[model samples]
Target: MKIARIEVDGARRVGVVDGDRVQPLAAHVTVEEVLAATPAERTALVDRAADGAPRPLSDMRLLAPVAPPTLRDHITFEEHLEGSLKLLGRTAPPPEWYEQPVFYFSNTNAVIGPDEPVAVPPGCERLDFELELAAVIGRPGRDLTPEQAGDHIAGYTLFNDWSARDLMAPVIPVGLGPVKGKDFANTLGPWIVTADELAPFRRDDRLALEMHAEVNGVPLPGGGDTSASMAWSFEEIVAYASRGAELRTGDVLASGTCGTGCLLEYWAQAGDAAPPPLRPGDVVTLVVEGIGSVSNRVVAGAEPVPVPKARVGHARRPRPWTST
Candidate 1:
């Protein structure tokens, strides 16, 4: 079953997308509530909602399926990371990457849904899109084992991690940020496909779904990479993510960019031959077989405001010397 969150007469409502129409659930129903239910209970709720009055999908405005309480993106694909690192003059990832999945938290407030416009961040010239998959957390877990973590997932959805490569460049060397470069926007929606629905596609812990992306009307190079190629499965990534901190329902754990999922990887591979970065009016669409697709149009961003100088310019006060 495909579950969606949509706008209905100025308010948000949860619904199930069936064919080209949507069956609206009770106004009080929410994806979070559904996630909190036991599998049998959740199935019963969807079955009952399916009998409600249906609305054409075209008439409803979809929202990000969940308003994530927290979001973390992980780099799990070796191909994508190997290509991305080339731009930074590295040919291979650090040995530590192979030991474990690494991740970064993103701004949850910036999440948008299908067909929304992605604005070019101020002072950014190399705008790009990352085609990835996100796993939604259904049950809370802390320091879970991979086998246990699998049971905590509610479902999956397509994710677009919009990026500002120009702004990202300077900070990568500083060891701590992708901050201003990435905090502006992220796209997640179309709908969430329940884990059971994707059971047939499961290969071990990773789904064997075919993934593809296109810019404007042209298909991107290496567009048919499969989700099965991920070096670390979502179960492993989620298990690592849950360490120490509790992962609550509605939290999102995104599988970072697939191989050639972003222009940056292509640029790193093609060098000066790569097509230019995204511009206003450009449309980017990503598709994952079984999960569905999400499309967004690029738009111009607001002018950046100037900043004042720092009060203390690296001055260190002298302390009385103590003999060792």
Candidate 2:
């Protein structure tokens, strides 16, 4: 079932999407409540008993499919990684990447849904978009084996890990960030397609989804094939994530940017002459085959809210170091 969060009377409600209309899922008001259902109960949202009064899907506003819990964006594509590192002058994949699927924590509260306008982060001149797949955790688990990971997933959604290349460039080699640049706004939505509903797209454990993107009505070609290009599977990522902490309900684990998914990768290929980054007033639409698409409008840039300068000391003392 295509599960969605819809706004009614300024309130959010959980609904199951059947074609162009959405049926409220039982009496639930938010996706957090819906994710609380047992895996069996979740699949049952497709049954007649769960459908509420139908509303035209076009009339409903879509929100991030899962409520904020913990958002983990993992890098699992060698092509995207290689391209990013190449722009930094590297020739091959980092050894540590093959050692384990790596990820970073992102601000879940900052997420925007379909058709919303993304205000360019203050001070950011190089705003960009990333196309990826998101997996929502269904069951709570820790120490799960890779083989046991699939059952813990509730569904999938399209994710755009928006980036501020200018904010990220300075900290790339330090291994500590890409933080402020990424924490601003990440986009997800157009509804969550339950795993069972996506059976036809599954090949073994991977889904054969083709990702596509368009900017300002022009196609941005070269998106990598999801199943073919990913070096590590979601199963592996989930298992690894569960190693030190519990994978809980509503948690979003995203497949990192696909090859040619963002301008950084484009710059790696096209070099110093690559096109200017996303500007205010640009519209970006990202689509995953089988799942729907999300379109966001870029608002005109303003002096981005300035990030405080990094300083390690809390106290002010003129040349505090006394040769201790």
Candidate 3:
């Protein structure tokens, strides 16, 4: 079943997509609640909702399937990593990257839904979009094995990790994760396709779904990548993420950019022939087979607030309780 959240007036409603129509659930029913329901309970809810008159999907405004409580993104595509490393003049990923899947937390407050506007941050000229797939956790689990973790996933959705490459360039040397470069806008929508709905697309553990991206009706670089190229499977990523923390319902775990999914990789690979950075009014769309697409328009951002520059402070003398 393809589940979606739609905007009714100013309120949000959850529904199941049936072809061109939507089977609306109760007003109080939320995507999170549906995800947490048992298989039997979910079937019953859908059955009950189907009894009501359905609405045309094109007539309703779609929202992000869920407002995630926690958002984590993992770099699992070997080709993406290798291509990205070329920007730093490296031809290969770090040795540790091969040992385990690496991920970083993103700001949940920055999340947005389909057809929303994404602003280019102040002073940013290199705005880019990452094509990715995210899994929503349905059941809570801690220290789960790969086999157990597979049961925790409710479904998958298309994810766009919007980036400000110019703002990111300086932060990389600081040894910290992305700050203003990211956390500005992240997109997860059109809708969520239940895990069972995508069963035919699964090859072993990795999905064989074709992923593609376009900018302003023009196809972008890295258009032929597939989820099957991921070196670390979602099962492994979920298990590793649950090592010391709980995976809660509505929590999102995103597969990092597919190989050549972003303009950064295109720029790194095509020095002179690369396209210019995104500007106001440009539209970016990411599509994943079996899942739907999430598209956004770029708009001008508000002026930034100024702050004083950092300065050196006096060092404090060391305190010693015992000296040898």
Q: Least accurate stretch of 10 residues (summed lDDT) in model 2?
A: 43-52
lDDT of 3 at 6: 88
Candidate 3, 135-158: lDDT as tens digits: 999888999999988789889999
Name the lDDT value of residue 99 in candidate 1.
92
Predicted candidate 2 versus true structure: per-residue lDDT over 20-60, tens digit per residue: 98876545445765565665775564463455578888888
Question: TM per model?
Answer: 0.95, 0.90, 0.95
TM-score comparison, 1 vs 2, better candidate? 1
- Candidate 2: residue 62 lDDT (0-100): 80
Candidate 1, clashing residue pairs? none
Clashing pairs in 3: none
RMSD in Å for model 3: 2.0
Q: Candidate 1 at residue 131, lDDT?
A: 91
The alpha-carbon deviation from the true structure for residue 121 of candidate 3, after best TM-score superposition, in angstroms, is 0.9
Better TM-score candidate (2, 3)? 3
Best first by TM-score, ranked: 3, 1, 2
Q: Which candidate tops lDDT?
A: 1
